[model samples]
Target: MALDSNENSDKSIHKFESMLKTDDVYFFDAEDFEDIIHHYLNNGKVSLGKKAIQFGLQQHPHSVELKLLHVEVLVFEDKFEEAGKWLDELQNIDSHNEEIYVQRANIQSKLDNHKKAVELLQQALELTDDSFDIHSLLGMEYLFMDDYEKAKLSFMRCVEFDDRDYASLYNVVYCFEFMEDYDGAIRYLNDYLERNPYCEVAWHQLGKMYFSKQMYQEALAAFDFAIISDDSFLGAYFEKGKVLEKLGKYREAIDCYETTIEIDDPTSHAFLRIGKCHEELGNDDLAKYYFYNTVHEDPLLDKGWLAITEFYFRKKQYKKALHYINKAINIDGENARYWKKCAEIYSALKNFDEADFAYKQTVDLGNFELDTWKNWVTVLQKTADFNTAEQVLLQAIEFYPEEAILYYQLTLVYLASDKPHEARKKLKSSMELNAEMVTHFKTDLMKYNRFSWITAIFADDKKASA
Candidate 1:
């Protein structure tokens, strides 16, 4: 309908221009001026609109519609004060006019006084015989205020007047999602589907709500319905693929994702998911192919790089994994997980210095995973960097105070450094935290020939308790 309207507007504009060119005086009525002015305004030709308004008033001096268009032009030009004065005059001239109230509300909305805008629009709603535009404006004002429920109601009212208001239908769904009312969204969308069974967006949104609740079969069916409504619905295909993957149907999921690529241009998300589905199906070569395609499609897609890196890691190809992970870090240097992966690969290759640096980057980037810290300490110990190991464990203990493992590692570091006093103190702390963890210290204590220290500490604790 919008396209048809635009086409008619273009034809009218061309006819009017032709008349002006052929005749010395191209006489037109107020309605002709309104159409020309509206065309120029909608097309963002403000100067043309202004010229039409001037010509319009000369032909029909008492045209309230022409006057309203002039005020709208003023508002569009950010001449809010001038527009307000015009609106006041219009209101006085026709006290029962709804357009005047609507224009006033638009100015108030622009001024960031949404409450005033809503009040004025509500007044217009009461006066106007047709409340469609009023309800739409009220919905927008409520949306600006983040009162999504009221906005939803207003938009629903607009929808009631015209079920073809696709924008309002979308907003109603958005409000339901924002409120986390999944059941409400399902009920609303079901009702919407009953009225407009061919609405692809409504079916897609219904599928999403079902997917969120882990109703995989229902989600799949909804997505199928959406695709039936619109065979070229790319989002429905993508979401349906996710549901298939969730249901452990990797091959079917890949087919759906591939269909999205065929329907539209390749998206990074679709490629990544296809790669993951292939990986799950144990088709490593295909997985690697899709993973490479994923990064090739979107160079900045961090997950694509991570997927390729994990592929190599799973295949025991540590060098390739390290290479891809380094590429990931270079692309997104602030990502802690990439740094942690780099640390892990370096540690696997026994490159302790590089491992230490990568671990430092991981911690600095706030990864703080127990494995990152534990392996960092292990690398330090492997490299005989006892002092740094002790320092790292101390920091780890602050974050993992309840974890007996960090304290146990600290105790071993102290003993390795010949700090018997610190060792005994740490060993006592670890035992208090978890007696089961004391077993880990036994093997290391025997290696250091400090079994007597462990026995003595326990005996001392027993004597104190007695």
Candidate 2:
């Protein structure tokens, strides 16, 4: 019906355009002018739409509809004040015209007056028998107000009016998901599927809901159904692979990911996931091949480079790991994970200076993990940079004030720096925080046993505890 209407409008539009070309006066009815103006406006030909409206108003001087179209064009051009005045005049001429109220709502929505927009849409809903568009608009207003329940209800009505309204269906699901009602989303999608059995989108969404809840078998079934409904559904194939991975079916997961590549162009994400699956299945050669493909497909993808770096690192190929990690850091120097990995690879290769620099970068990039601080301090100590090691431990203590290990490590730093007074103070603090950590301190203290004053302090603490 809509296509036929557009076709009919196209004929009127052609006639109107032909008349304009020949300086001929064409006589068209008010409805034909409306269709011609609407065709131009819908196709984004605003100047032509305005010309049609001018010609239309000339022919049908009392046409409320053409005047309303003029108001719509004004609103589209963001001439809200003029549009509002025209709407007011048109409403007085035709008090019950729903388009006036809808146009008012549109202007209000554009001005960020969502509440007023909702009230105006409510008025339009009362005046119109077909309320799908009004309901959709109300849903958007409710969403802007963060009223998920009302938004859900409005979009649900749209879905009920037209089950093929996938946009409204997605909005309904979004409302449910935002409210954290995963079970409700699953139930709603299941009910919708009962009425529309071949809805691949609903099936795919249902799969995601189940996946969020860790219902792997159900998610797998839903994704499989989505694929059955539409064999070339790339999203379903990709999600099915993720579910298979969670189920420890690596080979099957690889096949599902491979199917997505066959259905469409290969994405770097797919290549990366396939590489991970092959690695999990102990296929190093295939993993390496796909990992390379992943980076080649998208050099800017930090994950791909990190994956290749970690693969080599796990194999104890520190040189290869360092090489790839440098590339990853170059791609995303701000990424703490990349810097952390770079630090670890340098440490594995016993490059203390470079490792220390990478560790400092990792921390500066806001990675305050406990092991990050600990590893960074250890690198400084390895380089015999006692003063820097002391400063790093002091900073780590600020982050982990109650951590006994940090205090104990600080005590080690003090002893290394030949500060007996500071060393004893830190040792006491560590003992108070956690006395059991003293044993680990003792193992580290073996090198500093020449400091008899440190030995005396330990003996005094042990005696006091006894």
Candidate 3:
């Protein structure tokens, strides 16, 4: 009975061994094992790969390939400390082995020691006469190190060894771009296109390099090819739109921006460009609607608020402009432009106290523009805070000593505050800058000089505080 059982077990083992070897066909259990590994790798299931590797070892004990793959799986799992143990075991068994060195390099690359990875790959290069993969890996390591010159050299070697590799050609082109060799980048990419006509990244990068060099038409053509190759290439479409914008093709630019917005809603720049394109095409309502949509999509985006604020400002809608600009300030209170816009709107609305506060906020944010200084003086003077107004005017004069408006403004503040003696000192400064200051001031203020709206408040001291 024991012998019969032993014979049956032996037959079953023989059948299993036969099944493991592929007989003139690729169908085998080993193929299933590789599929599992690939699935684990693609899904980032490092633990499962590790467990699978252990189970696979029981079936195929002498597979050095599997052992090597297990190390890769450990590294992918971010179990670098554990991967080190496998490396030590591999080193002891196969010291000076080229493949072991490459595996170690891959492990080191995962740990971000790219320089060490490159040095290890160089050693592997000495062992193999025709090693395109070793060179490609070296290029990838150098790219990670930001050594674009070395990366380009290594990637060029990979192309020479295996020009069929599209990624290798693309890597060399990217290195040229990173090194700022626009001509070299274009030349290599063009050569690559002649060999592999469907390289999408090369097409996109060629467009980007040409755009950077101010070759707009060539950029458009390259982007055309890139978008044709991958219809969902949002970045390529965006570049195409920007090139069209620079070439004064507003309608085509709008189409490209709209296309990109359809694919990529998270891009704040796309919405902004589309809104500007609509504005350029004399579509104010469409522009305003898209600007509002951008704000709805990303409430935290400063550009969205700026766009909406500018929309209202352009329409002379001071209150709406103030609302959006104030929302912008609330989102990011330190922004100088929002504070300035709010101050301008409040001044236009005759909200003098709020205008003073807004101008002071702009000043606090270090905005020292000439007009910003002028606005500050106007708001302070309107508030009957002539003391602060004089201080602000002097600061403006310090920066713009020859500005006729600063001296004239100081004179206005003094004359308005019932201090003609202080007004006389400012009058001399005004006279030095302007032979016609009094005429211009009187002429400009004549429209609003009907001080019924302005003087009603200054008629009482507590009026300003109110």
Candidate 4:
């Protein structure tokens, strides 16, 4: 009889404890709910946190914590105007609520009102007696402004108040890195590694810093540690592959790019790096295959076409280069740069008529480079359009008066028109300008290297005089 009575009493006690947990406390405990909401917000559970806060708001309709949390939730959702509206609500609820003003300041910061944010933070500093988060927030505002030195000071204060939080310490490492204070970054990162050996972001950052300083071996060590910290670390793989390439380990670099591609990232730049590695290994056919795949896979990538064109251009295959350049130009017909490239390849093949037309189109479509215009003149001379050719040469001279070769070319244009005296005068002027070309070459003044072209016109003089 006594054992049964004891069991029933224990069951009742358990039931009452469960009821108390489910029931709202008679005493207002807004801080407890605020802390819970903050935890969820930081952990990316905004929806669940919002729901919990809504329930708390209903329980305590006049609580400043509820309104502040609502504003924070709106900010997390990127509803800036809605956040401002709630911020206004918070200020109205109780103008004397110091926490409400600080929360409003946070919303203003999110709205990118830096001046107002600083003013509010300063005011909050006095009200909260220089609270650690307010100082951190000030530092964060400066950090967003890329003020690394001031950001470092803010993070330092954060650590002083709460030494256990890793985030502020992490900011210190980042600030040092951005400031180019590499020694300080390395020292702090090493110290942090003692407590957090698996901090992949810090390790990855250290590798990048050392890499920039050309400390290749040390960079490799840091990247390797970062990769080991997280096996699926794509950033670490990219860094490691870059270092490997610098070390002339092309094969290893190729493997790393392949692994990154296998991770199924559709927008992977790994294909680009992999193709370059194949090109370095003297497997141009394989390199071309990858480049073509990259182009077809991501049809909008200009880099893919550029890679394909460069491969053949490097191989001295002008026809193959022209084919790809034309294809690239077709995709973006108004792209003057591609048209210029097409014109260049045509010039290389001595297909001057086509090259001139392409260059004209390039200039028409907004290419204004001196080199492009000079290329135009060279193509025109090859095509025997001395009239058009002279105009282009004059444009070059007009822009660059010190070019003696341009004046020399102008003399050729006059001689082509059978005006010998005019040609001689211009030749003398060209020699005066350059001085080094006075006795250079006799036969260079002919159009397109076909010196015999002048004879057909001069033959008329021979008949008339006879």
Highest lDDT against the true fold, candidate: 2
* lDDT tens digits by residue: candidate 2, 1-466: 0112367777889999998899898989999998888787777788988999999999999998889888888888899999989988888888898888989998998999999999999999999898888899899999998999999999999999999999999999999999999999999999999999999999999999999999999999999999999999999999999999999999999999999899899999999999999999999999999999999999989889999999999999999998898887777789999999999988998999999999999999999999999999889989999899898888888999999999888888888888889988888898899988787767687678787855765687679899
Predicted candidate 1 versus true structure: per-residue lDDT over 1-466, tens digit per residue: 0011255556667766776577555667787778888887777778877877887888888899999999888877789999989888888899898888888888899999999999999888879778887898899899999999999999999899998888888889888889989899999999989989988998999999999889989999999999999999999999999999999999999999999989888888898999999899988889989999999999888889989988888788999999999988888999888888888888888898999999999999888888888999999999999999999998998888999999889988998999999888988898899987676667677676545867764565569789
Candidate 2 overall lDDT versus native: 0.91
Q: Write the per-residue lDDT of candidate 4 for residues 212-301, one digit (tens) a residue.
A: 788999999999999899878888888899999899898999887777777657442577777878898998888988888888788667
Candidates sorted by TM-score, descending order? 2, 1, 3, 4
Higher-lDDT candidate of 3 and 4: 3
Which regions of candidate 3 fall more than 4 Å away from where they truly are?
1-32, 110-112, 129-133, 157-171, 198-200, 227-235, 259-270, 298-302, 313-322, 325-466
Cα lDDT over the full model 3 = 0.78
lDDT of 4: 0.75
Give candidate 4's TM-score.
0.60
Q: lDDT tens string, model 3, 227-316? A: 888999998999999999898888999899889878766577787788878888889988887788788888888888988988888789
Write down the RMSD of candidate 2 (Cα, Å).
5.1
